[model samples]
Target: MKICVFGNSHTACLIEAWRAVRLGGEMDFFVQAGTGPAGMQLADGRIEPESARHRAFLERLGLPVRLDLTHYDALAVVGCGISKFRLTDVLNCCHVLGWPCPNPSDLPVITEPCLRAALSDALAGTTGASLVRRLRAARADVPVFAIPQPAPSERLLKMRCTGGGFRRLIRQGLALHAAEVFRQVARAVCSAEGAVFLPQPDATMTHGILTTGSFSTAATRLVDLKTPHPDQDILHANGAYGAVVLEALQAALRQGGKPCIPR
Candidate 1:
Protein backbone atom coordinates (compact mmCIF):
# COMPACT_ATOMS: atom_id res chain seq x y z
CA MET A 1 0.00 0.00 0.00
CA LYS A 2 1.15 3.52 -0.79
CA ILE A 3 -0.33 6.13 1.57
CA CYS A 4 0.22 9.87 1.63
CA VAL A 5 -0.10 11.61 5.00
CA PHE A 6 -0.60 15.34 5.56
CA GLY A 7 -0.42 16.80 9.03
CA ASN A 8 0.95 19.43 11.37
CA SER A 9 3.82 18.90 13.85
CA HIS A 10 2.71 15.40 14.84
CA THR A 11 3.45 14.12 11.33
CA ALA A 12 7.10 13.56 12.09
CA CYS A 13 6.44 10.94 14.75
CA LEU A 14 4.20 9.00 12.38
CA ILE A 15 6.69 9.08 9.54
CA GLU A 16 9.51 8.05 11.83
CA ALA A 17 7.48 5.23 13.33
CA TRP A 18 6.41 3.93 9.93
CA ARG A 19 10.04 3.91 8.78
CA ALA A 20 11.28 2.33 12.00
CA VAL A 21 8.90 -0.63 11.92
CA ARG A 22 9.04 -1.14 8.14
CA LEU A 23 5.31 -1.88 8.24
CA GLY A 24 4.07 -4.38 5.61
CA GLY A 25 6.67 -5.59 3.12
CA GLU A 26 5.19 -3.71 0.20
CA MET A 27 4.01 -0.52 1.98
CA ASP A 28 5.28 2.87 0.83
CA PHE A 29 4.61 6.29 2.48
CA PHE A 30 5.17 10.01 1.85
CA VAL A 31 4.62 12.85 4.30
CA GLN A 32 3.85 16.58 3.89
CA ALA A 33 3.84 18.62 7.07
CA GLY A 34 3.48 22.19 8.35
CA THR A 35 2.63 23.88 11.60
CA GLY A 36 -1.02 24.48 10.58
CA PRO A 37 -3.18 24.99 7.52
CA ALA A 38 -0.65 27.42 6.10
CA GLY A 39 -0.58 26.45 2.39
CA MET A 40 -3.36 23.93 1.78
CA GLN A 41 -6.56 24.40 -0.16
CA LEU A 42 -9.35 22.45 -1.87
CA ALA A 43 -9.55 23.60 -5.45
CA ASP A 44 -11.20 22.08 -8.55
CA GLY A 45 -11.85 18.84 -6.67
CA ARG A 46 -8.36 18.32 -5.26
CA ILE A 47 -6.25 19.22 -2.22
CA GLU A 48 -3.04 21.16 -3.01
CA PRO A 49 0.08 21.82 -0.92
CA GLU A 50 1.10 25.42 -1.65
CA SER A 51 3.16 26.52 1.32
CA ALA A 52 6.92 26.88 0.70
CA ARG A 53 7.57 25.48 4.15
CA HIS A 54 5.46 22.44 3.34
CA ARG A 55 7.20 22.04 0.02
CA ALA A 56 10.65 22.43 1.54
CA PHE A 57 9.84 19.88 4.20
CA LEU A 58 8.72 17.46 1.52
CA GLU A 59 11.83 18.18 -0.52
CA ARG A 60 13.98 17.42 2.52
CA LEU A 61 12.12 14.14 2.80
CA GLY A 62 13.02 13.44 -0.90
CA LEU A 63 9.37 13.34 -1.98
CA PRO A 64 8.19 14.68 -5.33
CA VAL A 65 7.71 18.40 -5.86
CA ARG A 66 3.98 18.06 -6.52
CA LEU A 67 1.79 15.66 -4.56
CA ASP A 68 -1.77 15.05 -5.75
CA LEU A 69 -4.16 13.21 -3.44
CA THR A 70 -5.63 11.27 -6.34
CA HIS A 71 -2.20 9.75 -7.05
CA TYR A 72 -2.13 7.84 -3.76
CA ASP A 73 -4.08 4.79 -2.61
CA ALA A 74 -5.14 6.48 0.65
CA LEU A 75 -4.75 9.69 2.64
CA ALA A 76 -4.25 10.04 6.39
CA VAL A 77 -4.58 13.42 8.07
CA VAL A 78 -3.47 13.86 11.68
CA GLY A 79 -3.09 16.66 14.30
CA CYS A 80 -5.04 19.28 12.42
CA GLY A 81 -5.41 21.58 15.42
CA ILE A 82 -7.67 19.59 17.73
CA SER A 83 -6.81 21.66 20.82
CA LYS A 84 -6.43 20.39 24.37
CA PHE A 85 -9.30 22.55 25.58
CA ARG A 86 -11.72 19.64 25.88
CA LEU A 87 -9.46 17.89 28.36
CA THR A 88 -8.59 21.17 30.07
CA ASP A 89 -12.25 22.02 30.45
CA VAL A 90 -12.87 18.78 32.25
CA LEU A 91 -9.96 19.45 34.62
CA ASN A 92 -11.12 23.00 35.29
CA CYS A 93 -14.65 21.89 36.11
CA CYS A 94 -13.32 19.22 38.45
CA HIS A 95 -11.44 21.87 40.40
CA VAL A 96 -14.64 23.64 41.44
CA LEU A 97 -15.76 20.58 43.37
CA GLY A 98 -12.68 20.63 45.60
CA TRP A 99 -10.82 18.23 43.35
CA PRO A 100 -7.93 17.80 45.75
CA CYS A 101 -10.38 17.12 48.50
CA PRO A 102 -9.37 15.85 51.91
CA ASN A 103 -11.42 12.73 51.29
CA PRO A 104 -11.34 10.96 47.92
CA SER A 105 -14.52 9.08 48.73
CA ASP A 106 -16.48 12.30 49.15
CA LEU A 107 -15.38 13.88 45.90
CA PRO A 108 -18.18 14.66 43.51
CA VAL A 109 -18.71 12.37 40.56
CA ILE A 110 -17.82 14.30 37.42
CA THR A 111 -19.80 13.73 34.24
CA GLU A 112 -18.03 14.48 30.99
CA PRO A 113 -19.68 16.88 28.56
CA CYS A 114 -19.32 16.79 24.79
CA LEU A 115 -17.18 19.64 23.51
CA ARG A 116 -18.57 19.78 20.02
CA ALA A 117 -16.67 23.00 19.38
CA ALA A 118 -13.37 21.12 19.16
CA LEU A 119 -14.55 18.97 16.24
CA SER A 120 -16.62 21.74 14.67
CA ASP A 121 -13.63 24.05 14.63
CA ALA A 122 -11.28 21.38 13.35
CA LEU A 123 -13.55 20.09 10.55
CA ALA A 124 -14.49 23.50 9.19
CA GLY A 125 -14.26 23.51 5.36
CA THR A 126 -11.19 25.72 5.45
CA THR A 127 -9.45 23.60 8.04
CA GLY A 128 -8.20 19.98 8.27
CA ALA A 129 -11.51 18.44 7.23
CA SER A 130 -11.33 20.32 3.97
CA LEU A 131 -8.39 18.21 2.88
CA VAL A 132 -10.33 15.00 3.57
CA ARG A 133 -13.44 16.17 1.72
CA ARG A 134 -11.46 17.48 -1.24
CA LEU A 135 -9.69 14.14 -1.56
CA ARG A 136 -12.94 12.24 -1.46
CA ALA A 137 -14.32 14.54 -4.12
CA ALA A 138 -11.25 14.03 -6.26
CA ARG A 139 -11.24 10.26 -5.91
CA ALA A 140 -14.44 8.84 -4.52
CA ASP A 141 -12.94 5.35 -4.54
CA VAL A 142 -9.95 6.23 -2.31
CA PRO A 143 -9.96 5.76 1.45
CA VAL A 144 -9.38 8.76 3.75
CA PHE A 145 -8.69 8.42 7.45
CA ALA A 146 -8.53 11.18 10.07
CA ILE A 147 -6.27 10.23 12.96
CA PRO A 148 -6.58 12.26 16.14
CA GLN A 149 -3.27 13.53 17.60
CA PRO A 150 -1.94 11.24 20.29
CA ALA A 151 -3.39 11.66 23.76
CA PRO A 152 -1.69 14.00 26.27
CA SER A 153 1.39 12.60 27.99
CA GLU A 154 1.26 11.23 31.54
CA ARG A 155 3.88 13.89 32.40
CA LEU A 156 1.03 16.39 32.33
CA LEU A 157 -0.37 14.90 35.51
CA LYS A 158 2.98 15.13 37.31
CA MET A 159 3.24 18.91 37.37
CA ARG A 160 2.49 19.07 41.06
CA CYS A 161 5.79 20.75 41.93
CA THR A 162 5.16 23.62 39.54
CA GLY A 163 2.01 24.62 41.39
CA GLY A 164 -0.14 22.98 38.69
CA GLY A 165 -1.35 20.16 40.94
CA PHE A 166 -2.40 18.21 37.86
CA ARG A 167 -1.40 14.92 39.46
CA ARG A 168 -3.71 15.46 42.38
CA LEU A 169 -6.61 16.77 40.32
CA ILE A 170 -6.78 14.26 37.46
CA ARG A 171 -8.98 11.26 38.21
CA GLN A 172 -8.83 8.18 35.97
CA GLY A 173 -12.58 7.73 35.54
CA LEU A 174 -13.14 11.40 34.72
CA ALA A 175 -10.25 11.45 32.27
CA LEU A 176 -11.52 8.31 30.50
CA HIS A 177 -14.99 9.81 30.21
CA ALA A 178 -13.57 12.95 28.58
CA ALA A 179 -11.71 10.77 26.05
CA GLU A 180 -14.91 8.88 25.14
CA VAL A 181 -16.76 12.14 24.60
CA PHE A 182 -14.07 13.43 22.22
CA ARG A 183 -13.88 10.09 20.39
CA GLN A 184 -17.62 10.05 19.85
CA VAL A 185 -17.58 13.55 18.42
CA ALA A 186 -14.66 12.80 16.04
CA ARG A 187 -16.33 9.62 14.77
CA ALA A 188 -19.64 11.35 14.07
CA VAL A 189 -18.15 14.30 12.22
CA CYS A 190 -15.52 12.41 10.18
CA SER A 191 -17.78 9.44 9.37
CA ALA A 192 -20.53 11.76 8.08
CA GLU A 193 -18.03 13.22 5.62
CA GLY A 194 -17.07 9.73 4.32
CA ALA A 195 -13.79 9.65 6.24
CA VAL A 196 -12.79 7.09 8.86
CA PHE A 197 -11.76 8.57 12.24
CA LEU A 198 -8.95 6.60 13.90
CA PRO A 199 -8.69 7.08 17.63
CA GLN A 200 -5.38 6.72 19.54
CA PRO A 201 -4.34 3.14 20.23
CA ASP A 202 -5.19 1.59 23.63
CA ALA A 203 -1.57 0.75 24.49
CA THR A 204 -0.50 4.40 24.38
CA MET A 205 -3.04 5.86 26.82
CA THR A 206 -2.55 6.35 30.56
CA HIS A 207 -5.03 7.94 32.97
CA GLY A 208 -7.36 7.69 29.95
CA ILE A 209 -6.31 10.99 28.31
CA LEU A 210 -2.52 10.83 28.43
CA THR A 211 -0.07 8.75 26.38
CA THR A 212 2.31 6.39 28.19
CA GLY A 213 5.83 7.52 29.19
CA SER A 214 7.66 5.42 26.61
CA PHE A 215 5.66 6.78 23.70
CA SER A 216 5.69 10.36 24.99
CA THR A 217 9.45 10.63 25.57
CA ALA A 218 10.58 12.29 22.35
CA ALA A 219 8.99 15.08 20.31
CA THR A 220 10.45 15.33 16.78
CA ARG A 221 10.34 18.76 15.13
CA LEU A 222 11.29 19.60 11.53
CA VAL A 223 14.81 20.86 12.30
CA ASP A 224 15.51 19.86 15.86
CA LEU A 225 17.08 16.57 16.89
CA LYS A 226 16.11 16.76 20.55
CA THR A 227 12.70 16.44 22.16
CA PRO A 228 10.87 19.72 22.67
CA HIS A 229 11.06 21.65 25.91
CA PRO A 230 8.93 20.51 28.81
CA ASP A 231 6.40 23.19 27.94
CA GLN A 232 5.51 21.44 24.66
CA ASP A 233 5.28 17.98 26.25
CA ILE A 234 2.13 16.27 25.08
CA LEU A 235 1.94 18.06 21.75
CA HIS A 236 4.31 15.47 20.22
CA ALA A 237 5.14 11.77 20.61
CA ASN A 238 8.09 9.44 20.12
CA GLY A 239 8.43 7.01 17.20
CA ALA A 240 7.10 4.19 19.38
CA TYR A 241 3.73 5.93 19.59
CA GLY A 242 3.87 6.38 15.85
CA ALA A 243 4.36 2.60 15.46
CA VAL A 244 1.20 2.03 17.45
CA VAL A 245 -0.68 4.43 15.19
CA LEU A 246 0.62 2.67 12.07
CA GLU A 247 -0.45 -0.67 13.55
CA ALA A 248 -3.93 0.72 14.13
CA LEU A 249 -4.15 1.91 10.54
CA GLN A 250 -3.09 -1.55 9.29
CA ALA A 251 -5.81 -3.11 11.43
CA ALA A 252 -8.35 -0.69 10.03
CA LEU A 253 -7.26 -1.52 6.48
CA ARG A 254 -7.50 -5.27 7.11
CA GLN A 255 -10.81 -5.14 8.97
CA GLY A 256 -12.22 -2.63 6.44
CA GLY A 257 -14.46 -0.99 9.01
CA LYS A 258 -14.61 1.94 11.42
CA PRO A 259 -11.55 1.76 13.69
CA CYS A 260 -12.10 0.75 17.30
CA ILE A 261 -11.23 2.91 20.32
CA PRO A 262 -9.41 1.06 23.09
CA ARG A 263 -10.92 1.77 26.49
Candidate 2:
Protein backbone atom coordinates (compact mmCIF):
# COMPACT_ATOMS: atom_id res chain seq x y z
CA MET A 1 0.00 0.00 0.00
CA LYS A 2 1.06 3.57 -0.61
CA ILE A 3 0.75 6.29 2.04
CA CYS A 4 1.56 9.96 1.95
CA VAL A 5 1.99 11.99 5.16
CA PHE A 6 1.94 15.72 5.45
CA GLY A 7 2.64 17.98 8.42
CA ASN A 8 5.40 19.24 10.70
CA SER A 9 8.07 17.81 13.02
CA HIS A 10 5.90 15.31 14.86
CA THR A 11 5.11 13.65 11.54
CA ALA A 12 8.76 12.71 11.27
CA CYS A 13 8.52 10.89 14.56
CA LEU A 14 5.39 9.13 13.29
CA ILE A 15 7.28 7.95 10.21
CA GLU A 16 10.11 6.64 12.35
CA ALA A 17 7.64 4.88 14.60
CA TRP A 18 5.95 3.21 11.62
CA ARG A 19 9.34 2.14 10.31
CA ALA A 20 10.01 0.45 13.62
CA VAL A 21 6.75 -1.48 13.31
CA ARG A 22 8.06 -3.09 10.09
CA LEU A 23 4.52 -3.79 8.92
CA GLY A 24 5.80 -6.65 6.66
CA GLY A 25 3.79 -5.40 3.73
CA GLU A 26 5.32 -3.40 0.94
CA MET A 27 4.84 0.36 1.05
CA ASP A 28 4.38 1.38 -2.57
CA PHE A 29 5.45 4.90 -1.77
CA PHE A 30 5.70 7.28 1.18
CA VAL A 31 5.97 11.00 0.74
CA GLN A 32 6.46 13.48 3.57
CA ALA A 33 6.58 17.26 3.58
CA GLY A 34 7.42 20.11 5.99
CA THR A 35 9.71 19.84 8.98
CA GLY A 36 9.82 16.51 10.77
CA PRO A 37 11.62 16.90 14.12
CA ALA A 38 14.47 18.99 12.73
CA GLY A 39 12.22 22.03 12.25
CA MET A 40 12.01 24.37 9.21
CA GLN A 41 12.66 28.00 8.43
CA LEU A 42 10.30 29.73 6.01
CA ALA A 43 11.11 32.56 3.64
CA ASP A 44 8.48 34.75 5.25
CA GLY A 45 10.19 34.39 8.63
CA ARG A 46 7.24 32.63 10.23
CA ILE A 47 8.13 30.20 13.01
CA GLU A 48 5.60 27.55 11.99
CA PRO A 49 5.87 25.20 8.99
CA GLU A 50 2.14 24.75 8.31
CA SER A 51 1.57 28.27 7.11
CA ALA A 52 1.18 29.05 3.40
CA ARG A 53 4.33 31.14 3.52
CA HIS A 54 6.21 28.19 4.94
CA ARG A 55 4.96 25.92 2.15
CA ALA A 56 6.24 28.34 -0.48
CA PHE A 57 9.46 28.68 1.48
CA LEU A 58 9.94 24.91 1.33
CA GLU A 59 9.58 25.02 -2.43
CA ARG A 60 12.47 27.47 -2.51
CA LEU A 61 14.36 25.11 -0.18
CA GLY A 62 14.23 22.45 -2.95
CA LEU A 63 11.52 20.27 -1.48
CA PRO A 64 8.77 19.01 -3.77
CA VAL A 65 5.82 21.41 -3.59
CA ARG A 66 2.96 19.16 -4.74
CA LEU A 67 2.27 15.48 -4.31
CA ASP A 68 0.82 13.16 -6.97
CA LEU A 69 -1.94 11.40 -5.06
CA THR A 70 -2.89 9.13 -7.99
CA HIS A 71 -0.28 6.55 -6.92
CA TYR A 72 -1.26 6.35 -3.25
CA ASP A 73 -4.09 4.36 -1.73
CA ALA A 74 -4.12 6.17 1.58
CA LEU A 75 -2.98 9.48 2.95
CA ALA A 76 -2.36 10.34 6.59
CA VAL A 77 -1.98 13.84 7.92
CA VAL A 78 -0.12 13.88 11.21
CA GLY A 79 -1.32 16.30 13.88
CA CYS A 80 0.85 19.27 14.80
CA GLY A 81 0.55 22.32 17.00
CA ILE A 82 -1.95 24.73 15.47
CA SER A 83 -1.70 28.42 16.27
CA LYS A 84 -4.90 30.21 17.21
CA PHE A 85 -5.81 33.72 16.16
CA ARG A 86 -8.90 35.69 17.10
CA LEU A 87 -11.36 37.12 14.58
CA THR A 88 -10.55 40.63 15.71
CA ASP A 89 -9.68 43.25 13.11
CA VAL A 90 -6.05 43.41 14.12
CA LEU A 91 -3.99 40.24 14.44
CA ASN A 92 -1.50 40.20 17.29
CA CYS A 93 0.10 37.80 19.74
CA CYS A 94 -2.77 38.22 22.19
CA HIS A 95 -5.27 37.56 19.44
CA VAL A 96 -3.39 34.49 18.32
CA LEU A 97 -3.35 32.93 21.80
CA GLY A 98 -6.67 34.41 22.96
CA TRP A 99 -5.11 36.10 25.96
CA PRO A 100 -6.67 39.19 27.50
CA CYS A 101 -5.11 42.36 26.14
CA PRO A 102 -5.50 44.76 29.05
CA ASN A 103 -3.52 42.61 31.46
CA PRO A 104 -0.66 41.48 29.21
CA SER A 105 0.95 39.78 32.20
CA ASP A 106 -1.43 36.82 32.33
CA LEU A 107 -0.79 33.46 30.70
CA PRO A 108 -1.84 33.03 27.09
CA VAL A 109 -5.31 31.71 26.40
CA ILE A 110 -6.17 29.03 23.82
CA THR A 111 -9.50 28.17 22.25
CA GLU A 112 -10.84 25.27 20.22
CA PRO A 113 -11.83 27.24 17.13
CA CYS A 114 -8.30 28.33 16.21
CA LEU A 115 -6.91 24.84 16.38
CA ARG A 116 -9.78 23.47 14.26
CA ALA A 117 -9.21 26.00 11.51
CA ALA A 118 -5.51 25.25 11.34
CA LEU A 119 -5.94 21.48 11.09
CA SER A 120 -8.73 21.82 8.53
CA ASP A 121 -6.68 24.08 6.30
CA ALA A 122 -3.63 21.84 6.44
CA LEU A 123 -5.54 18.67 5.53
CA ALA A 124 -7.70 20.35 2.92
CA GLY A 125 -4.71 21.76 1.06
CA THR A 126 -2.44 18.73 1.32
CA THR A 127 -4.99 15.94 0.87
CA GLY A 128 -6.75 17.63 -2.03
CA ALA A 129 -10.31 18.10 -0.75
CA SER A 130 -11.32 19.48 -4.16
CA LEU A 131 -9.39 16.73 -5.89
CA VAL A 132 -11.12 14.19 -3.71
CA ARG A 133 -14.43 15.69 -4.74
CA ARG A 134 -13.47 15.35 -8.38
CA LEU A 135 -12.28 11.77 -7.85
CA ARG A 136 -15.56 10.85 -6.23
CA ALA A 137 -17.34 12.41 -9.18
CA ALA A 138 -15.24 10.21 -11.46
CA ARG A 139 -16.01 7.07 -9.39
CA ALA A 140 -12.50 6.60 -8.02
CA ASP A 141 -11.89 5.39 -4.50
CA VAL A 142 -9.27 6.49 -1.97
CA PRO A 143 -8.83 6.67 1.78
CA VAL A 144 -7.67 9.60 3.86
CA PHE A 145 -6.90 9.64 7.56
CA ALA A 146 -5.99 12.33 10.02
CA ILE A 147 -3.83 11.09 12.86
CA PRO A 148 -4.60 13.21 15.88
CA GLN A 149 -1.91 14.28 18.28
CA PRO A 150 -1.82 12.32 21.50
CA ALA A 151 -3.58 13.70 24.56
CA PRO A 152 -1.50 16.51 25.94
CA SER A 153 0.47 15.67 29.02
CA GLU A 154 1.83 18.46 31.15
CA ARG A 155 5.23 16.84 30.94
CA LEU A 156 5.18 16.96 27.15
CA LEU A 157 3.87 20.50 27.12
CA LYS A 158 6.78 21.79 29.22
CA MET A 159 9.24 20.42 26.71
CA ARG A 160 7.58 21.67 23.53
CA CYS A 161 8.74 24.69 21.49
CA THR A 162 11.19 25.78 24.15
CA GLY A 163 13.37 27.99 22.00
CA GLY A 164 11.59 31.21 22.85
CA GLY A 165 10.33 32.03 26.30
CA PHE A 166 7.12 33.70 25.20
CA ARG A 167 6.45 31.14 22.53
CA ARG A 168 7.08 28.33 24.96
CA LEU A 169 4.63 29.81 27.44
CA ILE A 170 2.02 30.22 24.75
CA ARG A 171 2.53 26.67 23.52
CA GLN A 172 2.38 25.21 26.99
CA GLY A 173 -0.87 26.96 27.68
CA LEU A 174 -2.43 25.80 24.46
CA ALA A 175 -0.98 22.31 24.22
CA LEU A 176 -3.94 20.35 25.56
CA HIS A 177 -6.45 22.56 23.81
CA ALA A 178 -4.56 22.10 20.57
CA ALA A 179 -4.60 18.33 20.94
CA GLU A 180 -8.34 18.44 21.57
CA VAL A 181 -8.81 20.48 18.43
CA PHE A 182 -6.87 17.93 16.41
CA ARG A 183 -9.05 15.22 17.85
CA GLN A 184 -12.13 17.06 16.64
CA VAL A 185 -10.57 17.48 13.23
CA ALA A 186 -9.83 13.77 13.06
CA ARG A 187 -13.42 12.94 13.87
CA ALA A 188 -14.76 15.36 11.28
CA VAL A 189 -12.40 14.16 8.56
CA CYS A 190 -13.09 10.51 9.26
CA SER A 191 -16.85 11.07 9.28
CA ALA A 192 -16.71 12.92 5.96
CA GLU A 193 -14.49 10.38 4.17
CA GLY A 194 -15.38 7.10 5.85
CA ALA A 195 -11.78 6.92 6.98
CA VAL A 196 -10.22 5.95 10.31
CA PHE A 197 -8.55 7.78 13.16
CA LEU A 198 -5.82 5.94 15.08
CA PRO A 199 -5.20 7.10 18.59
CA GLN A 200 -1.79 6.60 20.15
CA PRO A 201 -1.34 3.49 22.27
CA ASP A 202 -1.84 3.37 26.04
CA ALA A 203 1.56 2.09 27.15
CA THR A 204 3.01 3.86 30.18
CA MET A 205 6.65 3.39 29.27
CA THR A 206 8.21 6.27 27.35
CA HIS A 207 11.81 7.06 26.52
CA GLY A 208 12.13 9.63 29.27
CA ILE A 209 10.58 7.38 31.89
CA LEU A 210 12.99 4.49 31.33
CA THR A 211 14.86 3.00 34.25
CA THR A 212 18.65 2.77 34.14
CA GLY A 213 18.37 -1.04 34.25
CA SER A 214 16.42 -1.05 30.98
CA PHE A 215 19.57 0.01 29.12
CA SER A 216 23.14 -0.89 29.74
CA THR A 217 25.21 1.90 31.24
CA ALA A 218 27.15 2.18 28.01
CA ALA A 219 24.01 2.41 25.86
CA THR A 220 22.51 4.95 28.22
CA ARG A 221 25.71 6.96 28.07
CA LEU A 222 25.64 6.91 24.31
CA VAL A 223 22.09 8.19 24.33
CA ASP A 224 22.74 10.80 27.00
CA LEU A 225 25.92 12.03 25.36
CA LYS A 226 24.19 12.48 22.03
CA THR A 227 25.64 9.68 19.96
CA PRO A 228 24.35 9.33 16.43
CA HIS A 229 20.57 9.89 16.19
CA PRO A 230 19.95 9.80 19.92
CA ASP A 231 16.96 12.02 19.36
CA GLN A 232 15.50 9.51 16.91
CA ASP A 233 15.79 6.61 19.28
CA ILE A 234 12.77 5.20 21.10
CA LEU A 235 13.64 3.32 24.26
CA HIS A 236 10.07 2.16 24.82
CA ALA A 237 6.48 2.89 23.95
CA ASN A 238 4.59 4.81 26.62
CA GLY A 239 1.31 3.26 27.79
CA ALA A 240 1.19 1.09 24.67
CA TYR A 241 0.62 4.15 22.57
CA GLY A 242 2.51 2.72 19.62
CA ALA A 243 0.79 -0.63 19.93
CA VAL A 244 -2.68 0.88 20.00
CA VAL A 245 -2.03 2.89 16.84
CA LEU A 246 -0.62 -0.16 15.09
CA GLU A 247 -3.64 -2.21 16.10
CA ALA A 248 -6.07 0.45 14.87
CA LEU A 249 -4.35 0.66 11.51
CA GLN A 250 -4.33 -3.10 11.17
CA ALA A 251 -8.04 -3.27 11.94
CA ALA A 252 -8.79 -0.54 9.41
CA LEU A 253 -6.82 -2.34 6.70
CA ARG A 254 -8.39 -5.69 7.57
CA GLN A 255 -11.82 -4.21 6.83
CA GLY A 256 -10.44 -3.45 3.37
CA GLY A 257 -8.88 -6.93 3.08
CA LYS A 258 -5.41 -5.40 2.84
CA PRO A 259 -2.38 -7.37 4.00
CA CYS A 260 -0.50 -6.17 7.07
CA ILE A 261 2.05 -7.51 9.49
CA PRO A 262 0.66 -9.67 12.25
CA ARG A 263 0.76 -7.78 15.52
Off by over 4 Å in 1: 25-38, 41-48, 83-126, 160-169, 224-232, 257-263
Model 1 / residue 184 / CA error / Å: 0.6
Give the top-scoring candidate (lDDT): 1
Candidate 2 per-residue lDDT over residues 1-263, each given as its tens digit:
66555444334334444555656443321222322312332232122244565555545434444445555566554443221111111123333455323435553544546645655665444333332332233223555554543333323323444213223434346433433454566455444544445544424212321112222111211111112223323222222343355456556666772322111
List, residue by residue over 42-154, the lDDT tens digit for candidate 1: 56545545767756756666545455655666677777654334445444444323223444444344533323553354444424566566556666676788887776678
Tell me the deviation in Å of residue 230 in model 1: 5.8
lDDT of model 2, residue 236:
21
> What is the overall TM-score of model 2 with all chains considered together?
0.43
